[model samples]
Target: MSEIVLRNVCKEYEKGNFAVKDFSLDIHDQEFIIFVGPSGCGKSTTLRMIAGLEDISDGELWIDDQLCNYFDPKDRGLSMVFQNYALYPNMTVYGNLAFALKVRKASKSEIDEKVHKVARILEIEHLLDRKPAALSGGQKQRVAIGSAIIRRPKAFLMDEPLSNLDAKLRAQMRIELAKLHKELETTIIYVTHDQTEAMTLGTRIVVMKDGVVQQVETPIELYNHPVNLFVAGFIGSPSMNFFQAHVTEENGRMVVFIGNPKDGKKIYLEGRRSELARLRAMDQDVTLGIRPEDIHEYADAAELGIEKATVGMNVTVTAREMLGAEVFLYFDEQKKTHAVRLHPKNQTMTGEKIDLYFDPKKIHLFDQNTEESIFYREETV
Candidate 1:
């Protein structure tokens, strides 16, 4: 198995600064793991440390049963695909793919066989005669990937290899890469700033922030159940909306009062007995979170068979964005701006006031002080 382990790994530079802090994870065989965060989040830094391109200031890196913290990149039984296509500008695709084998002193026939096999797998056989200058962006990337896998390394590490492609090509290559992972059945560690790429490509995603690991989970889990405010905001496109509210108990239920009750922004959380008890016990301010998909108009909820809107608020459509199948409605309530998604067919007009509903069961509450999800902390505790 090509399982890789990182134990308390850290990368520190001058002046007591660290690029990665106490980073640890287990990447199982044939698993696709993505390290994702905003720029400068240390994802690329971590990948470089794993590839032996950067020195680890502390901790251990193990591949299979071998300690690889001090091993050379070539000796670590791993190959990397980089963001920039590192193909030789002076050589043909065939030469580039066979470069590693030539360096290892493999026989010419052996090199030819491996190169052709990898070219076939990457669907780049037809482009073998082309040089880097002659290839398109996507084709050059394919050649780059083909060259990396030509040696049949135990594991593959890719650092934002698709960032150079256009949106259409990026999407197409996502599918191709997914297929390659399945066929090759090799462990993969990918680093990217794109959450969409992380969600669609990785078997599991590691979300990071400020050079620190925040959460690691499957994409769906990270989406439906984020560990903190950062994960909840980063994992979803259009992000989750947040509002500061005061929690109080009334009539054996928890009422979250946000903005102003006079403005119709107050709502009660129901049906969660344990959560209610916890909220009632806390006299502190809390942050309320709801995804755009969960905020809907009363009629919209009923039409979609969603549970009846537990909380009602009157909001104005400040801005409207039509996205073919769905629309994004931005509004302000209780002095806080928020957005809700609706079917485009609903014909919502800007500047119009309408009553919207929030699904009580779908709401997320976070501690204002820690910015951690209350639900997540409760479950883990």
Candidate 2:
């Protein structure tokens, strides 16, 4: 089993400057772990350090009980699939897949068997005689993966391996990679800025920003519960909508005033949420977080039993996009654009005004100063 443990790992490029700071995680065997963040967030750099491509400036890197901070990349028993495919243009697919085994002086017959087996798994058997230059982006990637698979390394370290492909090809490759992961049953450490890939493929995701890991959780856990504002904002497509709000007790119930309370728009919190807000942030400003899907139209709000006050948000539709299965309506609120996902049958047009309601149970609250989720559970984190 390939269990990797990082304890307070820091990658300092300069004396006082760091690329990764105090990062720690216990990655279990056969787990599809994703390192996701925006550009230059050090997701790739962290993966590189684990692969021994870069020096670990501080802290320990343990692989299955052994300190691997000083191990050579080749000695680390991890195969890396790169963004560019990294296939040898001069070599045929067969040659590329067989190269690693040849270096170890594996028998010719053994090399052939492993090459064909990996080719079949990756579905590149038909393209074996073709060179890298002749293959499509997906085919070339399959060959690159085949080369790695033939080696049978302890784990796979992939750094944006699907970034170069188009949207359609990327979607296809994502499915293929998921299947490959299952068939091989190996641990995968993948780095990508694409949240879609991370959400779809990862068993657990590590969200990083500016070299620091924000949170690590299962895909559903990260989506439903994020520890901080950055993670809540970063993990979703179209992202989570944020609103400036003030929390205060009204008639013994915690109420949040959206934007200017003079507009007569507010949402009431109840039970644990209200209690938590009362104890920690009564009368303080908070950032209300809600997803597009959580904001519903009047009919939906009524059916969902959301109170009338919460459904009182009146917004002018600035833009409307019909995405076949779902429609996205955008509006300007608090000087920032917010989106709402609705049924494609929505007939609301640009310049029209419509009322929207937030699902109170699905609402998230973050402290304005700390930017930490007020509802964050330390046990889950």
Candidate 3:
């Protein structure tokens, strides 16, 4: 049961600047955790702290029942897979896998057995005799993983292991990596900047920004209920769209004022009592957030139980991207590039004006001052 507990961990360097601030979490045994964010977000720094490669300036690092803040990386009983293959060019895959074992003084028979077992598990046994240069990128990665797994460490720390691979290969590796986690039953801490990898591979994802942890949650929860504007924008591909708007009570309902007040394109929230109250209580100028898929062509609204909009905006299509499965329509709105996803067969052309509908129930509202989700703050609390 190799659980890890971090209590108010921090990494500070030079003149009180921190690369990781007040970082804390409890990672359970056999869990696949991913640390994700943009460059210089302190995700990799945090992972290095866990691996004992970086100093923790404050707080505690506990692995299992032992304090490991100052423990040597090898003494901490964790192995790491780096982004670079790091295999010796002249060494066969089998030799690279057994090199560490040899350094530890394992007998030849023992080394041979361990290397073959890990090779078989990673499905690279057929290439065991091949040198590093003879293998493809994916094959070399498998060798790197095999080298790490042969020791049977307490946990595996992977630093963007798939970053060097192409798109199609990366997708395949994500699935394999997930399967490996389950089969090994070892705690895994992975770091990457790709949201798709974070969503697909992690059992739990840690979102970070500028040396601070923003949120940690299951993939679906993070995607469905982001806590702030940064998360909502960073988690999804193409991201969520934001519109500057003000909220006010109109008659017995709460309405979101979009575009100009003189314009007739506003969303009405009448029967949504709970959401209405949540908005009306703190209602003011807010950024309205919506996903591309949430916007629908008028003909498709009924299938989703969304009623006809009493008022809607005519969006002029400025660009379109076709992916065979669906189409993304881009339009300029209030000086922003807003997008909507529609069925591929829909004949939306560039420079064409079409009425698009926004689903009020799917809309998210953020406080203009704080840029935080009013609904999420209350729910999380």
Backbone clashes under 3 angstroms, per model = 0, 0, 0
Q: What's the CA error at residue 194 for candidate 2, in Å?
A: 1.3
Question: Candidate 1 or 3, higher TM-score?
Answer: 3
Per-candidate local distance difference test: 0.84, 0.92, 0.86
Better of 1 and 2 by TM-score: 2
lDDT of 2 by residue, 199-278 (tens): 99999999999999999999999999999999999999999999998889889878888887787788888778788788
Q: Cα lDDT for residue 111, model 1? A: 91
Summarize candidate 1's per-residue lDDT along 160-222 as a digit string, tens digits: 999999999999899999999999989999988777788898899999888899999989988
Number of the top candidate by lDDT? Answer: 2
User: How accurate locally is residue 199 in candidate 2, as Cα lDDT from 0 to 100?
Assistant: 95
Model 3 Cα lDDT, one tens digit per residue, 1-381: 699999999999765898899999999999889998889989888889999999899999999989999999989999989999799888998899999999999999999998988888889999988999999899899899999999999999999999999888888888889889888999999998788889988899999999999999999989888988898898987889999887776775677778666786677764543464345434678888889998888787767656454356788999999999999999999899998999998898999998888887777777877877766855544
TM-score for each candidate, following the candidate numbering: 0.94, 0.98, 0.95
Rank order by lDDT, top first? 2, 3, 1
Can you tell me which runs of candidate 1 are displaced by over 4 Å?
Answer: 261-264, 273-281, 303-309, 334-336, 377-381
Model 3 spans with C-alpha error above 4 angstroms: 270-283, 377-381
Best by TM-score: 2
Cα displacement (angstroms), candidate 2, residue 313, comes to 0.6
